[model samples]
Target: MKGLALFAVAFTGALLLYATGDFPDWGSLDSPANGGELSTHYIKEVRKETEVPNIVTAVLADYRGFDTMFETVVVFVAGIAIIAVLRDFGNGSRGYPPALANNLPEEPDLIVTQTCNLVIPVLQIFALYVLAHGHHSPGGGFQGGVMLGASYILIALANGVEAAMKILSERKILLMAATGILIYSGTGLVCLLLGENFLDYHVLSRILPTDPIMARSHAMLFVETGVAFTVTAVMFSIYANLATRGTLKGGL
Candidate 1:
């Protein structure tokens, strides 16, 4: 086993080193990507088209909205998959935490619990800031969602998974996950209803009385909100399941 692991690590390193030969030198202006027509197009037109200064955000939430919507669905599906496997569904409890393996209840750490009480609100605040500021800066739905998930995990670590569940029940988590995906795909459906291609943000202009371009930008923000909801719920769901080994009663 150790020998095979060593061989795998060495092979991976060798492959990475060999692949570096095709990569451009550090910050090389003449790199194929820098000079590519696609890159040039995005550089010149993305800001004007999306009205979002952050090029990556514009590309992800606008240019690739359909792809990103499905990507969010993937994240949602993953959470559901884990819940399906770990949750006890034999009885009426479809998604609730399973029973404890033993009778020994976990005691909370006073210091950790008190500190988390102080820190969780701050983390949640930062998460919302990141979600809302993605178009203007270097934060977005996935990043913000992870931060929110971390807050819940901190609570789980400080108190217990059951305590975290009390704050957000299993049903609520599932609801949030589904709701996020709904918001994403629903936006595209709405565009289709307005006589445009799926996810064509300009079609929203028929309803909003704004310029098509600006409407696209605003649509990106709504899409990002959906992403945030699903990502946050899924992250917490996975952690809760793994930390408590499906029971979600106790944790470190």
Candidate 2:
């Protein structure tokens, strides 16, 4: 059995390496992607079709929305998996390993805590700005969510996990994560209900106070906001669980 498995792995690796031989040369102008009408159409017509200035954002939130939505789902699932694997619901202290048990200080450091306090608010505000302006700028939902989650993590590191939990409780984290996916799916569902294909943002023009092109841009922002919500919640939740060994109490 072991020899058969090894042979299978070797065969698969050889097959993949052989397949790569057919790939186009680096930066070849006649490459399928470079020579195709697809890239040309996206570059020339994306702004006119969606009114989203950032071509990448337009492609992610409008052209390839289903793929992006599933990517967010994958992130949420990973967070949930960590919680499932590590969380301990039973009452009372399970006791920490020797490395962690004696390391906690009696009190948080004054300078570190104060610095985090000063920085956290500003960090969170910038995160929101990134989420809102993603269609026009380089920043977006994933980047903003990471920043928001990092602020909570900074609180945990400076003052301990308990302080961070006060702001984002375990229940709140789960709710926020689920809500983000709901917001993304619900937008697509709205489009479907309006007699259009899923994620067809142009259909939103009927309800929104805008034309079709602007509606696509607006819908992209909405989905990006949803992505931000889930990412922010899941980011903090994963940290809180790991730091406290899933008890969500009394850890840095």
Candidate 3:
């Protein structure tokens, strides 16, 4: 009763807040966000510094890359936490059947299975394309990685957890996550070795004869790849644990 009353009050407050004009208009070209203080400066400075056609990608990868690095680490840590909590503590046997262990339905719909079979491959390809072309577009490492992980989930649902796990073994997922972090952090450390600030791409250009803009673009690509790898592995690890109901099934 008290909880229900609280929920009602909270819902009412949310409705009131929505009534206020606090949210920005969708895609308003003349609005301050599109033409105002921050956008004005970003438009002027981003092209001059990064020479990338996609302003959002440039901001995320170059201007505020340190923040992006920490965000990636956060996702990695969340994966580790889920794995630790959900790992089977029992005997060596595949812990439990998916339906019995997870309290999930034994059978899924045919439509879902057929749709997943059709869509998963396309999603995988799209994720890779997004990661590869992030510098020239709105899509980037985080979005691409999530999409990749979603593709794996679709496969797991369409086929089975055991089948998905066979393809993406636990050992491989751990190695991929670790490697992603290492690649990102190692790049920064390499910059430090070259007598520049960590993640400094200007120093990279000195060694490669590429222009500064190109150097930065290359660095962003490397970092994005690392992020995509970690995110994809971590998300799959999470789905595996949940689908198996915290059981360490040898297959899934």
The C-alpha RMSD of each candidate to the native structure, in angstroms, is 4.1, 3.2, 4.6
Better of 1 and 3 by lDDT: 1
Ranking by lDDT: 2, 1, 3
Per-candidate TM-scores read 0.87, 0.87, 0.79
Q: Per-residue lDDT for 200 in model 1?
A: 86
Tens digit of lDDT per residue, candidate 2, span 11-75? 99999999999999988998999989998899999978987788988998899999999999999
Cα lDDT, model 3, residue 94: 62
| Tens digit of per-residue lDDT, candidate 1, span 28-65 | 98899898888888889987788888888888887888
Clashing pairs in 2: none
Look at candidate 1 and give me any clashing residue pairs: none
* Runs with alpha carbons beyond 4 Å of true place in candidate 3: 1-39, 90-118, 248-252
In order, what lDDT does every prediction score?
Answer: 0.87, 0.91, 0.82
